[model samples]
Target: MTLAAPIDPLAGAPGAYRDDLVEVVRTRHVPIGAIRTDSFAFWTDHDRVHLAHDLPAERIDNDLAGLVAAELFAPGWLEGSELFERLMTGLVVSAADDPLSAWTLFYRNTMDRLAQLTSLRPGAATEPHHGALVEGSLAGYAPVYRHAAGLIEPGSVLELGSCFGFFSLFAADRFAMTASDLSANTVRLLGRVAPLLGRRIETVICDAARVPRPDTSYDTVVALHLLEHLPAEHGAAVVTEMQRLARRRVVVAVPFEDEPTAAYGHVRVFTARTLIEIAIASGWSWTVHEHHGGWLVLDRP
Candidate 1:
């Protein structure tokens, strides 16, 4: 049976936008089945799976409709099992593309949706699907951005493991932001997009554990939602590296998850105790607290 079409957030987008998306899907090399796994799933596909397991077939059908409504899957692309496979294949390829142009397209779509959502009149009716897409894209990160912003010290800041550099962009007006990440694609995307967004932020492609900058290079160093993606020892090394790079303070944040959310590529779980242990091991004047997640703030002498 064919699934009903969901609202298209990109319905009126320029022809070029649709062309770009189609090109990305056409050129994708990886198969969807090859990328689907028990442990790691695409964030967009997470609802179809439950705790690292696929939901029952009936549930998945329901979930796929939800995904379509959220704009994670294209409208009318769920008419058959083959189209569903195409949808997943497009998502997997778009995420893994080294140039990251596909990911950029997705980002642009979300931003456009957000703009439309915000332009509505007070008490205006919002399409539930658009609301879901906007919420899924920004809701989790917005509070964390505000929390981290409150803790950051005045002066220059360096953010390690800055995937997509969204936090860096969020705080750019308040700080001299430099966002570094291990992925060249992400760094490149950030460098290209920051100016377009009216933000001035520097981008560096480097490992967080071994940044090339000299000691005391910035007044504040941040590693938000980053440690959980690294091994324990590597995370510790990154903490030490943050100290070496900051003259004033080091800030770290991790989700308080019972188990890592592999869809986001999280490899380990962290709690308040683990954050406190990290602070103690650093031997810095530190404060540990929970906001949306666990945070360890280390003040330098």
Candidate 2:
């Protein structure tokens, strides 16, 4: 299936696009404020609460508690109590030792919960798809997350096309993580879901092709599984924008042409050579020797 926009039709949207209720902010600097988009307010401010503080410690439990707790500060945030309990209880059965295992469980479980509440399927824009397909797409990018964790320098981190905000939450442990997506609803989903799971991630609505931030604003910029969804020339434009926004390195990942996969809304396939060519043309100096999940690591230094 071919799409001009490369947007997934079955990826479980929260509700009718509520531009007003979709955007929420809670920080020391800004008060809990919102604006109504069209007419109806889909949700209320009470839905967004300090979940960790309001709910008992026992209620907020998960297999990744030991690994994720250290990164989250007290008075942690969350969107819904019912959803939180349901998600944590669902994950208690998994006994994975690795940190990545727990993260994967959290991501999949939350996605499942969203799928149930909405009429979201997994397939082409016109067809109904299954949950396993979406889960596979999520897991396919694990190597990119692992590689970025090791190479990321000490500074602010900005992840373009940060679908689900899992890596952004993971990177938040080491750096100030900011996640951006073209859709406000997508960013809003991360902003709501991250805090509920006791993960700290700052969400923003912006286009990867034209981020509003200034040049050299972040130490590292990452775009994973996003290039394949764009035309080669458009992908290059995003790479150029990533270079402008990044000070040290711009790490990107697309599906390796050799791997067998089925991903929705993926427009173009990329190989190591083609990705490297784009990186070189974008003025990146050093290429990290290590490659995982078809990662193209381009460092300016």
Candidate 3:
């Protein structure tokens, strides 16, 4: 059907970073699949619209359209058949080949779902503050995701705050991924979607600072974009717990202190020095990347 065409990587808003994002997706291909379960009997038209939240800014419409054309609405595939599942699975694998593409697919679908649920057109109206908020918020995680793909070892991973389960899903194919978050509904929803996506993830509803797991349970423990949601004391406690639970390494990320926008419930911000200091103070050697956000990797002493 050719819903969209592959976009030119170079074509985007000025300093838009379209190409860089595409490169992130290419570095590691996360496993994605579309499995038809008795639970979700059919991928209906409503389902497609329901899953996506809202459209992105006009600048990336071509990119978004290209993804739909490449993955979901491919020409000559029988709609509402096993072929659809195959197409979806292929899309997951292919999108993983380019992190930007995967990001596009994920966010596009997510925005659609959010739009339908909230009745707000996220990218359409484009108020300066709102538009900047949406754009900055979305792009802020690219480097963090890229660094995680590069640094995480092939082993079990425990993600402390798997909001929306994006990174967990992204890494599930390569690592035995488990996620914990405070919201039980979010945890429950991730459980529902994991199987449909052909990924296995253990979900736990617990406080991040006191996960009910033994020390050194997973090889890598991820706490991306979590610290800002906590006070310094609570964040330190979570870090302590993260170190205790990780046998080998811990990955942490936070928005830079100078970042202009703040999401709801964010209690603090951090910088390269602050994040590195936090890790070293816990007796772990670390490396910090001052990109989109600050990403820090700490290894056991």
Candidate 4:
């Protein structure tokens, strides 16, 4: 379930453990995005999309929109869509008639479209970058943080390297959490679109090596795809920083795919054995779990 030194698994995987394709989920109520929820598929006076997971609007399509979004922005998501333009206009009209509905509408629509984007699932790594990097939205690289209940708490969240702040926004909007990223441009772009989605994100540009705050600031800290970017030693240091900031838990996921491909970006590639050793040496009370593309999740105390 892990890789050791001498063979760092996170190294930009060649042939990325994932397949190179874009997947998306569709629903009726959703004009052109994934099905939102299990409510009646209908639009209100304010022009909103609502639908549950059954009935005429049964839960059918659920593709890789989030993943694609993540991949589009090189680990980020695009908030600058025509949809937002329309939503903002609606918000002005709905603000007076239905303020509560107005805000929820923003969140619902934002999350809905966000879900449509691609995920980092199984193939983004091996695929050619091409035009995917434009618009700063990776349509196919969403990290599955749904299971990380602790990370989604309505509290402060400190992410080590929020490449594009996609996961950070997911945590903040869905769970009332706040997110911070290390990249200035990433933070700015994320900030511009955050308010439109009815979410608030506080990003700080700092070296992942030393986050401004100490450990225990955030309920959960996630370094989803960051490890692979640094040399083994720096990657470990980033893990240490995440642990210090996470008051409750630290979650890490790394790619498991083979190397020599265009997607793998790590200086060293790891095998199963070394993966475990690195987790331990990094000072994370680690537990490796199964992740897409043969990646591993190490949980720390």
Task: Pick the winner on TM-score between candidates 2 and 3.
Answer: 3
User: For model 2, how does the per-residue alpha-carbon lDDT over 19-66 read when each residue is reduced to its tens digit?
Assistant: 211221211232335222221111235323221111212222222232
**Higher-lDDT candidate of 2 and 4:** 2
lDDT of all predictions: 0.62, 0.53, 0.57, 0.46
Model 2 scores worst on lDDT over the 10 consecutive residues at 12-21
Residue-wise C-alpha lDDT for candidate 4, range 1-301, written one tens digit per residue = 3321221111122111111111111223345553233222222323232221222211111122222233332232223332222222222222222333333343444456445433333344534332333222233344345444333445565766775466777666555455555556445655665777666778777878788875477776777666666787787788777767777666666555466222233455556676677677756566665544223444454
Across residues 1-301, which tens digit of lDDT does each residue of candidate 1 receive?
4453431222222211111112122222334553333222332242231111232222221123235323323333223332343343233233323323433454454444444544454335665441253312344455667778889878999999997677787788899999999877558767876777677999889999999999999999999889988998999899999999999999998888887744445689987888888888887899999877889999986
Q: Quick one: how many clashes does candidate 4 have?
A: 74
What TM-score should be assigned to candidate 4?
0.52
List of clashing residue pairs for candidate 1: none
Candidate 3 local distance difference test against the native: 0.57
Best by lDDT: 1
Off by over 4 Å in 3: 1-137, 259-262
- TM-score of every candidate: 0.64, 0.56, 0.57, 0.52
The candidate that wins on TM-score is 1
